[model samples]
Target: CNAFSEIHGLTPCYTLNGSVLKDASDTISLDLCSCDFNADGYRLPTEAEWEYAARKTISGMQSGLTASGQVDKYGKEDTSIPEEEVSWSASNAHGSHKVGTAGSPFTEDAPPVAGSGNPNGMGLFDMSGNVCEFVWDWSGRYIESEPGERASGPEAGSERVSRGGSWSEYTPFIYAGDRYSYDPNECYNYLGFRFVRTVK
Candidate 1:
C-alpha cells in the first residue's frame, strides 16, 4: 500500500508477513496481546471485535477490547431486513461470489463490483456471509468478563477460532454467536478471513 500511503499522507498498512498460513504453528508464543507478533502490520480481528462490528453494540470510535458471547450478529437486529438483502448464504449462493456482490452476477473481466448487497449499520459489506472468517483468538470455552471490559481468550488450544458463517452454511450460521474452531493447518475453501486494524 505504498502508493495508497503516499497519496493518503500516512502508511495505510504494511504486512511484514505475507501468506505464511500454510506453515503457521502454535499460538503459545503469541497467544494474546502480551506480545506483538507484527508490530507494524494489520492483525486479525479478535472474536469480540468481530461480533461488535457485526451487531454494533457500542457506537462511536472506541479502542479494541474483548467480550463474551454477548452481542453476536453480522448486522443490527432488523427483522424488517430479509437475510437475502444483505447476506449471501446457502439460501441465495451456489458458491462464494466476489466481494461486494452479495447475490449479483460477477464476471472475471468485469470491473470490480462494490456495494451489491446492503452494508451493515457500520457500512461494511459481505460481512454476514460469502465466507467464514478466521479470528485472532485461540479456541476454548467463553470466559466471563466484567461489563464494558474485554475478555482475552484462552492462553492456548489445539485449534484456532473462526467466526462469521459463509456461503456454504445456512443463514443462521452467517451471523455471529456461533464460534467455530479448526486446526490451523486445515484450510477449507469455505473458510476464509476478514482484515481489521485498531487505530491507535
Candidate 2:
C-alpha cells in the first residue's frame, strides 16, 4: 500500500503481519482469519458509522442558506445544492481529479482531500467520492431493528461491504446511502479505505 504519512501527518504506522490463504478452495471459508476486537488496532468503520458520517444536513454547513428562499452569491436558487458541489462523480469529473477539487477533472487519481467540495455534517472530507471505502460489515440485506450505538451487519459472509461511490461511478452511487461489495482479498485502483480506532 502507498504510504500516506507524507500527505497526512496523522497517518499511523501499520504492520502487515497476517497470513493469507494459499489454497484457492479455502477462500470461501470464514475461518481464514479472526478479529480481536478488544485489541488496540485500526479497523474499518461499520456500515452504519460510515453512512452516518457521510450524510450531510442543512445544519452541517458552516455558511450557506438554510431556508428555501435564500439565494447564494451566484444568484441561483439556493433551495438545495447539487451533489456535484459536494461529491466527485462522472457528471462533474470526467475522470478522477484531486481528492477535493470540486468539478476539476482529468487528474485521474484520488486527490489529497476534497479541495472545493463541501464536507459532511461531521467535517469529514471525501466521503462521497474519490474512492469507495471498505467497511467492516459483510454484504447482507438490511434488517428492521431497533436503533443502537453501533449497527453491525450479519455475523458472517463471503463478500465485504464497501460504502460511498468512486470517481468512476455516477451521481446515484456517489450518495451517502449507496453501498456495494467485493471479495475481501481483492484489490482495485478505485477501491481504497479509511480506518478508525477505539477511543478507549
Candidate 3:
C-alpha cells in the first residue's frame, strides 16, 4: 500500500471528496506498521478506524437499536436488514463474491444489485461482510489511548489483527466490533484488505 501510494506521490490514488475508494479492486495486505500515522503514503486503517467505519454501516437504524427500546427474547438485539441484503455470509454465500455485490456470490461480469451493496450511511461498501480486512495492529491486548493520541499496537507480535467477518462467517461474526488475528505469514482466501490515506 505504501509502495502504491508512494508511486502515486502527491497525486494521491484517492480523492478526498469523491468516490475515493469506490474503484478499489483486489488488495494485498502487508504486515507493516505499528499503525503508522506519520507516513506520507497510503496505509491500512487502524483497528479503531476500521471498527468505527463498519459500525456506521448500520447508521443505528437497522442496528436493532430501534426506538421501541426493545430487545429480543434471547436478551440480544437483532439487525433489521436481512443478512443477505447487507452481506454475503454463511447463510447466503458459498464462496467469496465480488466486492459490493449483494444477494449472491458475484462474478466480475454480474451486474451489481441495485441498493444491495452499500453506501451505508457513510457511502462505504462491503464494510460489514465481504472478506475480513487487515488492520494495522499487531495482535496484543487492547491498550487505551489518551485523548488526541493514536493507539500504536505492540512493538511486535506473531499475528496481525483482522476485522469485519467474511462470507464464510456466521451472522454473529459480522458484527462491527468483531475481530480476529492470524499469522502474518499465513494465507487464506477469507483474508483480504482495504487501504486508506490520511486526508491532508
Best by lDDT: 3
Per-candidate TM equals 0.67, 0.63, 0.71
Local distance difference test, per candidate?
Answer: 0.58, 0.58, 0.60
- Number of clashes found in candidate 1: 2
Candidate order by lDDT, decreasing, is 3, 1, 2
Per-residue CA lDDT of candidate 3, range 136-171, in tens? 788899988999887757756778898777777442
Per-residue lDDT of candidate 1, residues 144-192 (tens digit)? 8899765657766777788767778532376555567876667777788
Q: List the residue pairs that clash in candidate 1.
A: 66-150, 66-151
Model 1 accuracy (lDDT, Cα): 0.58
Residue 41, candidate 3: how far off, in angstroms?
1.4
Residue runs of model 1 more than 4 Å from their true location after superposition? 1-40, 57-76, 103-112, 146-150, 170-172
* Candidate 1 lDDT for residue 33: 26
Per-model RMSD to reference: 7.3, 7.3, 8.1
Q: Worst ten-residue run, lDDT, model 1?
A: 62-71
The residue ranges of model 3 lying beyond 4 angstroms of the native Cα positions read 10-35, 57-78, 103-116, 169-172
